[model samples]
Target: MALLSPGRLAALHQMGATETRVLQDKPSDSYERGYAEDVDHIIPSPTLFDSLRDQHLVPDDMPAISQCATHLELLEVFHSLRNRVIQSRYLDNAFNIHPSKRIVYHRKHRRQKKVGKELRDTGFEGRREEKWKYYLNIATARFEQWIQGIDTAMNDLEIPPCGRKVLPPLDVLVVWHAFLLNPADFKEYCLKKRLQHVQKIIFPWREIHEAIDSTTWRFTVPADQAGWILQTTLLEPDLLHTLTEDSHINYLARDLLRNLSESRWYNLAANLRQANDRQSAFMQTIHAAINNQIEHRPLVENVQRQCIFVDKMHAHRWIRSPAVQGTLTRAVDKYENFLELFRLYPNKFLVPTLDVDLVWHTHQCSAELYRGFVVDRVGRFINHEDNISRGTLDTGFTSTEEWYQLRFGEQYQVCLCWYCEAILSAVEEEEVKDGGSWEAVDVEEIVERVGEEVEFCRDLEISRQKGRRLPRWKHGAGV
Candidate 1:
């Protein structure tokens, strides 16, 4: 028989069966002169060898076992062959077996067979220690491979120093070899590294300490070794408010001021007068309106608190008279123009578009009461020059197209003026029939109408927010 392959020897060691016997007698011995020990099976028992083979405990190309005198001699001869195949096959098989089974196999078999009768005489404690040592060696080798895998994965990512370097958990290797392999679980292991907590783990403790010691790194202060750091250090609400005020983008502050002004809240009005004496007349008017609308109303009164204040009697009178309606309509147009100016430069003012809309809607509704003033006459004689002029005004490159190019550095333009003009003309004709002058409309009512109109426009804009109508960029297309 051929000598056992290294893989078979290792498998024998793994299965706790290493004893092999071959029949032999010295010719010089008188007692054994006529007798001979017959040749029997060598190395691992047939049952154990079958188990190892079924579990793929040895490499396929390894030779079958042959008679040998000692386990140590067998081990030496086995290791002399290409040990790579043996080591690889052992590791590959070991990973498939349950960690508990591996532990038990080593304890009951490998050491007992290697030391022969001495190990068999030793108690379970001695065997257990031997098993632990065996596992430690295997774990150390496996850990080296685990480290290599981590390094390989990291290199494949090729992330820059400034960019994120995601690291897999060391625990994953422990779990993978200890338990059944799972492809799905492996993917989840990768995702956890990208999160904030795991990202912190990638930095070495020494490097973290060095960063903490640096005076220039201002955001976080180091905590005592035993204590937890508070994340709330940077979340000062008062400081945030101050920053917003300094930046002039405090929308809440603007809204509060607007509401106080529109409702004519006198205490607030007095406070504003003291605080900002250089306030514009427009602001003063808004403040006075807020005071009258909100502060003066009786608590028990059942009247609807109008979102925008308007003179009801004046609105009724305007609705009755065409001349009044025409005047109200013109006032609505002017209010819209003022709103558009502010909308185009929202950042310059602290006011929100919603606030502008609120004011505009109130004014528009008041103007609507004057609809009786509009005339519904259509002229049969058309002036071609007027048509050409109107067409030119509507057709000339749209401001929106020019603005789009300026803002986005793209030449894509969709002519919305055609649609805008149609809407504007319809509103204009309707306004002429209601009332043509601006002064006849109540200022309060116009403000109310303007507010409502702004809200309507805002809603329309939001509905269209997701659609991107811009054309694709072409070569040589410059702004």
Candidate 2:
């Protein structure tokens, strides 16, 4: 994308790449009928009108007039045309009585954003996404080959090409056809699937539905009564409607006690109904509380105009301080080079540097010693009373400006370690003070408070660090 300019890209077109050809489409094949047909026929400038022919499908009868400017637009043309045909098919089929089958359509299907992600742990990633991604992989591979072909063709030309080269509309469509011909392109489409039948509503809903369904034998073929229970209590349009599609137990168990006229469901249904009532009432209360107690408006920070906050990317128009992107570009040296230069130097003369690989394995104990040193230094900075004379400091450590000046030189580092410390403090305070309330301390407010504290401490010098260590429970982690 960076290689091609907008002017060059716009000028590019695949002229005379595809010829008007008869599409050899057969009925049984679902994929070959849609975009594949359009590409095979090599129809140009196909509008919405051109798409609908031969029972609302792309027909080969239309003249090859429509053309895509680029391979990318051609791909879009393929999808937009194909989706129109397939989506109509689905919508039309929706009228046909869909049998009582447990179709597992994902409610929140998403792609795992982290590249080379696991096929498992499908909290968001769904089967549909898997199928589409698989198809896209095939298409991308085909497109790469097509681009390679175009490059080869350009090289064959006698007159030397200058700047970005353009491919005509026909070339774009031809590559698109190659993309569609890739077998992975149409694997496992939605319409081809027939979902597995759920044996019974299991667990929570299993016991509930079974208590109604199986108990039909206990009362001399109580079939209509069963239908009534399902339709009214569970809110299914009919008994044939599959409840497993979105199995919400509370909604399914509505009016369960009233429906459970049978003696067997008496005790269990009674207990369940009471719990359900409480849950329903509590849901309403939650909604009401959210409406009254929470501000729905998007929060904008307006007050704090002049910040010298560190941990950069804090851009404000009125801010006095400039943002520093980084302190050290290359802080670590190669182990052999570093050792050759400084290993013979006296302990007092040498500034310490971490040989990380060595610390990770051989000299691991040294890491713990360094960790204790930092922890002690931070502990002292937080505990000193003179540093925090205004409001009561939280129990956990926050980096003050005085701490910064004492440890790292005064203006050398604008330490906003206070933000991290405040976040930890807020979380701890919520767990203790919030009780059942869900409202948490505003993180922005913590930032503002930290700013105020830093403003106070930036000028003043204060003594930090205690002389000795006291006993406390120590926690350790390992790689």
Score every model by TM-score: 0.13, 0.15
lDDT of 1 by residue, 356-421 (tens): 222233322111111111111111111111112434444432553454345545432211111222
Model 1, TM vs. native? 0.13
Give lDDT tens digits, candidate 2, residues 309-418.
11121111001111100111111122222222232321312211222112111111112222233244333111111123223333111333233234434221122232
Give the poorly placed runs of model 1, Cα more than 4 Å off: 1-264, 273-282, 292-479
Please count the clashing residue pairs in each candidate, in the order shown.
Answer: 52, 12
Q: Which candidate ranks first by lDDT, i.e. highest? A: 1
lDDT for residue 418 in candidate 1, whole number 0-100: 14
Estimate every model's Cα lDDT from 0 to 1: 0.26, 0.24
Say what the RMSD of model 1 is: 43.2
Q: Lowest summed-lDDT stretch of 10 residues in model 2? A: 299-308
Give the 10-residue window scoring lowest on summed lDDT in candidate 1: 18-27
